[model samples]
Target: MSAEKIDLLNFLQAHPPFDQLPQQALEQAASNMDVAYYKAGSQIVELGQLLDTWHVIRSGSVEVYRRSGELYNRLSEGGYFGEVSLLQNRPSRFPVIALEDCLIYLLPKAVFSELFDSYEYFSDVVEVEDRSRLRHSVSQREDANQLMTASVKVLLTPNVLSITETATAHQAAIKMSENGISCLLITDLQSQICGIVTNTDLRDRLLTPGLALDTPVNQIMSPRVFSVEHNQQVFEAMLLMLRHNVHHLPVLKQGSAIGIITLPDIIRYETQNSLFVVSSIFKAQTLDELVSLKADVRACFVRMVREDANSRMIGGAMAVIGRSFKQRLLELGEAQLGPAPVEYCFVAMGSMAREEQLIVTDQDNAFIFDDNYQPSLHGEYFAQLGKFVCDGLAACGYSYCTGEIMASNPKWRQPLKVWQQYFSQWIDQPTPEFLLNAAIFFDLQPVYGKSGLVKQLNQLIRYKAKANSRFLACMARNAILRTPPLGFFREFVMEKDGKQSNSINIKRRGTAPLVDMIRVHALAIGSKAHNSFERLDDIIESKLLPNGRAEDLRDALELISIVRIKYQAQDLELENEPDNNIEPEALSAFERKNLKDAFQIVSDAQKFLRFKYQPGRAS
Candidate 1:
């Protein structure tokens, strides 16, 4: 190979679009390319310049800016520069200028067309972009910090080793020896967090003091818990343990104890290079690499389920990793087109924004920029970021919301004042459409940029809703629409649909009803735990649900969660579909019975909510 061809070939083997090309084809691509170098601040493509070549940065970065002097995006090494011009076959809308001394591989339009025609995968990047309409508004992010988990089946331990909070000190010790662990968590009768006893506590407190074996476990169990949510990285778990000077921590969902995490468990989960990509995602230089790391994310979830990881732990970890990816994507976007004169915070609205994502989820996002942004200065920057994030997420395996709730919608990306106006209008005149499905907005959490903005807005929402009886009633009435699945005879009801269409609809009938009910309760109480589980806990404390009812609802929610998890695991195993649906026929009689009772409990709560909110008649 010629010297130029050899250098270009090596470069192609490393970058995407060409990285997917086979060796011989890549060589042909390299041989067909011409190389060019640019000095800092040099213009590679001027505005009104006719379409020419597709330029790839082999080294250094280029800033794509409008001739009107507005900065567009920063494309660095291994990034393509003139795609816009090459794509439309017209004058460049954005001029490409070298931000630093740069090495660029210039592929003429003819050669690129030939390559695209030959290689099928080469067309995906464009196809993915062209078809991805909701993609142009949100900036993508990547940050890799790992807590260990399995990428394959992990060894699960059994023998039902656990201790009751009422168990005596002697029983705790005996159980520890029997199970061979230094630490044991005290589970309450309700299966919530109670306390923990380490082997050190066992030896130091019991043996040292010669305490009676019959003393309650709670008496000696050190209650200083440094816990993490489930599915949180083992690294985060380790850090929490280290910071709290605790050896064990309990993981909770909706304020109920779910599992335990320890330093040793951390070490075991991330065994065999699990931490490598977990750490590398943040260091990725290009968007392509971020897309690649997401594959590992799917692998982690698959592995977590295979290990029989509880839903709380699995969801917690996935939330963290998903946040990391988006955070990184945002960082890259901001670095490329941010620090603008105006303040803009990217809001992840649905699963992502709320730090709750299922294995197969849809994107929900919106932008809240400072109202003072001068159109001439910040519009393009925010626009580009919105586009990048929405698009990048789709590439990372989150299907675009069919409902078009993404930040890419110009209607959603607006100034904070505008957002307030939007919410105020939506709240004041809560229509059936808003009530039926708009709770996704209620679960809003700031995932990136200016969390204070989200905080301020949340405060306003509480202030507005607390006194707006009509609005509250509307929300509550809507919340009760999905009444618990109690039958006329109060029997456990399953889906009427058989094999093919049958599904218990855990998310819809079970979790969402309770979740929405809790949201209304939270609005009344102004609770900060927007999540259904956490919000329910707050409701329990607020005395909204009668003590007995609260207890029942908690158990119902837990059962729903546990049921969802088992189904999810089975789905992964079959490599069938991964969804929230549960077939009624698949359930054991006990499960079906329990699910029905759970459904009834939620339905009762729904009735209470509807009565409280009186649909048409009011006091």
Candidate 2:
């Protein structure tokens, strides 16, 4: 082969759909390839122009435009065009323009057709009319389980049971026992599902605490009952149950609570699942038993990956497991150390709090004591409680936070007033170092104890953060510091100084920046949602992003998160420690393309952030 043909073959082998072609066919096409060059701003293919060959970008960039003259897609090196026109044997519908001086490879229609017909992988990527490349990425997974496809309404029973919000705990228990129900949905005067009281909640909140039987069930019920729409799939219902570890999910139809679904219903529908581990975790009676469940946790994580659970589903499940561990440990701590001298809330911050935790995370938590807390008198008890729970968590595989952000840290163990002040200082007089500590704090959730205290903190943050423009600017600036892993050439920029040099930390480079920038938008919109995905929903609804950017961010987050999740699952399968650092070389051609697209989205979002909040530059 000539040197030019050899170079063309090498470039084609590096790109997708082409990379999947057989070597012999690839070389054949490369040898017959025609080269074309276009100057910046020049039209490579105008609307309705006859295009008989497929164009692959070899260098520089190109912009594909719709007939309406709207920017459709911007493609860099290794990107492809002319496939739609070539496949259909029609004139160009979407015109193509050179965004910069460009070198391109054109393969004749016959050769493209031969490869497209012969190669299954080639057909998968090239057939964009049926399914998008992004959807193709996820659809490649096996989704055969009946539960995955069936609607939650299929399992719905008309035997709905609920109690008034004003009902007593004893009356609720009686109602549950008389009805042979394990849970009763608590409704208000408007007959709306306000909370849920379960057997476990009664055991933990009423029986264990020796609360008065006449006390209102609302005092013991979980106010944040995660319900599902009647039309959602069974898999979604199961995911919600696993995500929040809730046994009962009230099913709603047109905004009215109509029925409920349980874990057993799902288990009967699909037995080979990980949610059983959560039920077992609450059943553990000792620290050793809880710690031993770590293996089960790993198994569940692996099963989710093999079952083709998406990043959001897997992350939510793992986070719920993590929270269960914390909750069970707190129960044990109270059992061993006795009840607390004062009511306090044990808050899980960071990823666990955000509902985006993975199997490889460390503990990031804090304690919010009651405002009436007396340091000299009750300090020792709370201190010991923190140590007990934090130590137990480390035993169960959630290693201590290296930065000492755990509840055991004295710096984070403070009264409600102090926590409020902490937020005020962090926001009102934001500094680089303070912002680092404050990142996790902003995504806080109360896992145990007086949950009301955490609500107060969240309310404080929402009110304070939205009103403070300077603070938001500082946060936006801090968020922009963590750039995505894309280089000027659209290649992944890897770590320069580390043992894993030349590799990218998917968490820092991909997910972190995405989360941070989203947080700024969430703060700007005064959104109460904490999870990155939910925050994106709010940001989109608030109309805070340019057209298509919110969905771009969502897709980018899912792709990066799924990649991170799959790699971690791979580490578990290999019995090695799971981590976030991933070498680009290890990725498949398809994954590399998708990941690059995700990273580019992150980079675009960062640019938007800089432009949106240009603090110093903004007049």
Residue 292 CA displacement from its true place in model 1, Å: 2.5
Per-residue lDDT of candidate 2, residues 1-619 (tens digit):
6787778888888888777576888887887789899998899999999888889888888888878875566678888888888878889888999977999988898888888888766775666322332332454343334455556765776788989999999999999999888999999998888899999999999999999999999999999989887657788898888888889998886477788889987775453345677788899999999998888888777767764567777778889899998999889888988888888999999899888889989999988999888989888888888898899999999999999998888888899999999898988878777788678799999998899999998898999989988888888888888888888888888999968798999998889999999998999889999899999999989899987899899989988999999999898889889899999999976678778988998888888888898756312
Off by over 4 Å in 2: 1-272, 617-619
Scored by lDDT, model 2 comes in at 0.84
RMSD of each: 30.1, 18.6
Q: Estimate each model's TM-score.
A: 0.55, 0.61
Q: What are the lDDT figures for the candidates, one per model?
A: 0.70, 0.84
Supply the TM-score for candidate 1: 0.55
- Assess the local accuracy of residue 46 in candidate 2 as a C-alpha lDDT between 0 and 100: 94
Q: Against the true structure, whose TM-score is highest?
A: 2
Which of the numbered candidates is closest to the native, going by highest lDDT? 2
What is the per-residue lDDT of model 1 for residues 552-604, given as tens digits with 9 covering 90 to 100? 77667767876887787678768777788877778865576667767878888
